[model samples]
Target: MNAALALHGLSFNYGDRTVLRLDALTLQPAETCAVIGPSGCGKTTLLHLVAGLLRPTLGTVSVCGQRLDELSVSACDRFRGRNMGIVFQRLHLLPALSVLENLLLAQHLARVSRDGAAANALLDALGIGELARARPAQLSQGQSQRVAIARALVHRPSLLLADEPTSSLDDGNAVRAIELLRTQAQSIGAALLVVTHDRRIRGQLDREVVLGGAA
Candidate 1:
């Protein structure tokens, strides 16, 4: 079994404040893993490092067999665009744009042509097709969360990293969001790694890992 994502003695910190002290964590292809821990346990930092959003201060992180430290800035940006999708805790949608527009913008930023039909298909699959024309500010928290998921999956990234994506939803909507994530991950051959403190969702995932430091 090939490991899709791996971390080896990875450590990061802000000045004297230590965060993300991972040691030899790995996830196989097609794996749907849940990361659970208390607040400020370095879950988000780990995700950022895995996604190439941050360079490690020590050790190494790799995804799809590519070592993050070895890639050039431009190469890393392209690699992330072509292979990674992220769902942030804040959703990060543009208030001025409709949901459909927000997704289109993401595709444009990735240098991919905006395919309205495909975008609609993705929205439909995520059960948010009807909300396409709605702006982010107008939707409920649950609705925005679904839109974020749809945007993340629209480009079919091979690795999906989510940070507290479903934390704000009600129980029913939380399950729905997870189901949508699983469906997209399965269809795209993407390994889904979600970081959250929600214990209720543990049994819903195929695997679970705890984030921590040696301290």
Candidate 2:
């Protein structure tokens, strides 16, 4: 299988404290891998490193076979914006912007043009078509989450990273959201990495990787 992201002997520390120490991992294309563990087990650290938000102190981190160590920070940021779609816990939508505008803004940041038809179609699919004009402040938690999903997916990235994406959702919505993420990843031929402490999503993943586990 083709790898979308790979990490080799990844170890990171914040001053004297070591946060993550993974030997190796390679996520296959279209693979929906879940990183499941305790709060400080470094699930977020791993995702941040993969997303190029953090640098590894040891070994190499690669995305789409390009070694992160080789890429400059600015280049990494550009690569991340273009190739990775991230659904952060906070959603990070601009409160002043409407739903359509938020997605368009994200697309612009990725240096890609907005696909209005596709964006609207995705919102419609998420059952939020009528919310196109609604700002983030006007939407409920569920609606906001779907909009975040839409924003991440607007550019059809090769990797989709989620940090406990469905934590705020109810059981049904959580399952549906996970399914939607995986389904969209499959449709775009992207690898999906969902980091979560929620055990409910454990059984729904294609493969489960526990942080700090011996392999």
Candidate 3:
């Protein structure tokens, strides 16, 4: 079977400055890995590259056997929607929509059929079923984080990317959040790649990739 994610000679630069460089990286389906590094070490940049939000300045990123560099803009968006799920550091939930609507929107954007049952099931699994109709502004930080995670997995993506997933939680919640991510990703058979500076979660993952300080 093809690797869930593969990066070969990946390097990203901004003008004259180099931000990230990785000779090779790979993650098999249902495997879990963490990218741990300092503030400017391109942890988030790596996530974006894999998600196809930003193209690498050099080399290639392949997700689910398809090279991101080979896909057109529209095709890339579609592929990302169907094959990848991202829990951004900022938790970009729509304030105007209810929690359930946010998940439905993800499906709509991905061109997948809207399945309210699946959406609610994911919310319930995350232990936030009752909050499904609540607006983003009404939830606590931890609640909002869970909502964001639910949104990402609503479509059962093949690759799950999370950035700083536990940056705001206390020790207890941090552990719980990481466990939720791992359990959910495994259930969907997605490869889990987390970009985090939090050392608390390092031991929970299968392996860790430490990036050097910003170049």
Q: Would you list the clashing residue pairs of candidate 3?
A: none
lDDT of 1 by residue, 138-188 (tens): 998888888888788778777888888778888897887888787788787
lDDT for each of the candidates?
0.84, 0.89, 0.92
* Residue 67, candidate 1: alpha-carbon lDDT: 96
By lDDT, is 1 or 3 better? 3
Provide backbone clash counts, one per model.
Answer: 0, 0, 0
List CA RMSD, all candidates.
2.4, 1.9, 1.7
lDDT of 2 by residue, 138-199 (tens): 99888898899889988989899999998889999898889888887888788999999888
- What would the TM-score be for candidate 1 when compared with the true structure? 0.90
| TM-score of every prediction relative to native | 0.90, 0.94, 0.95
Measured on C-alpha atoms, candidate 3 has an lDDT of 0.92
For model 2, what is the alpha-carbon lDDT of residue 171? Answer: 95
Question: Compared with the true structure, what per-residue lDDT tens digits does model 3 show for residues 1-215?
Answer: 99999999999999989899989999999999989988888998899899998999999999989999999999998899999999988999999999999999999987789999999999999999999999999999889989999999998899999999999899999999899999999999999999998888878988789997521
Q: Which order, best to worst by TM-score?
A: 3, 2, 1
How many residue-pair clashes does candidate 2 contain?
A: 0
Among all windows of ten consecutive residues in candidate 1, which has the lowest summed lDDT? 206-215
Q: Candidates 2 and 3: which is better by lDDT?
A: 3
